[model samples]
Target: MFSDKSCVNATLISGTKETCSFFIFEAAIHWAEEGHRVIYIAPKALQSPPLTHHDRSNPSTEAFKLMRFMYLPNYETLVEQLVDLHSFASLPNVLLVDDLDNYIEDPGVKDKREVHIARLCAILLDTMNACAVILKQNVHICVSISSECEKIYQLYFDKLWKIEEEDDGNIVKVKQVAACNAANKTYEYRKYGSENIILKQILYSQN
Candidate 1:
């Protein structure tokens, strides 16, 4: 998704409370297939059964990496991991964070929800500047957040998208709600075969 820019950030919001793991997995696989290294960070590891799993057991395979948090991670710990992954001087990398709001909080301190959100945002922005922007490395940051968290996270990203399941759970709508580099866009997600999912761009009439 990133061509000219050394670093690009995007956000995805789920239209429903249900998880969007299928979409995330497809995206991760797509990036890895394109020769970019993917680092996936999740609050918990495989709490739900995935629709399909990507094979990454080969020792020589360096396409994907997964990191799960047993407990809430502090800013320092979070930054360190991101910096290390992004430190690959000549390689392209994608940092995929799933439900960041759930894993990035101070466990011991009882803080307001807003405060926790703010702190996470600060850390993410700082990491973007220090690790991605400064290094001039080809990096992509894609985060999946809930609707409530979208407002706070939107300002920090260059592109924002929303995915929702509709038509009694048969049809999926993927819309580009906000973007800095292009006009608004929308797409429909459909199944290609028994298990494959695909995206087709659709034009929406303003009327």
Candidate 2:
């Protein structure tokens, strides 16, 4: 779908919880097909999955199910999941990052925590020009990141959005805010939109 397109690179941050939660994955899937490595900045507090699974005789493994589905079983535990960094860096297409600020300002940690996380994100940002998907929980964290990466994605996200608790204390918000760039390029504000970017795919189907 993204055959003839060489315009500005725009990153869209969905605002609503439902949209923010799921839209990044869909964006990564779409962009990877076009050869962009999706570095997912996983949320600080990821929402827990619902309590529902088949009683298979085998072990109750989420990995097993993901493997069964289109997604490959990435890793077992959190530590293993960190290994995904190497996988994303080595791969030719999309990459999934659990969290960019894993140890940025973390206390009781090693000396390299800040430098390491910064280096990792810098590496991914430098590696690809297509787009990167960063998902952060809560508004403060997201705004902090957007501020930090402002220099990087100045040309990336044509639309940056926000999600917050309404006066009623429910958190379902979405708004397509306008954005400008150092290059003087302009983009339309969109609530839900997709660029022509694509991602790499499997050589063969599961079935």
RMSD of each: 5.5, 13.9
| The 10-residue segment with the lowest total lDDT in model 2 | 135-144
Candidate 1, backbone clash total: 0
lDDT by residue for model 2 (1-81), tens: 121123223343534443344445444444444444344445443454211112213323332322111122221232334
Query: In terms of TM-score, which candidate is strongest?
Result: 1
Off by over 4 Å in 2: 1-92, 96-99, 108-120, 129-159, 167-171, 180-207
Model 1: per-residue Cα lDDT over 52-90, one tens digit each: 423333322444443222222454555666556445554
Clash pairs, candidate 1, are none
User: In model 1, which runs have C-alpha deviations exceeding 4 angstroms?
Assistant: 1-6, 16-19, 47-49, 52-92, 104-109, 147-150, 179-182, 191-196, 204-207
Candidate 2, number of clashes: 17
Error of 2 at 131 (Å): 11
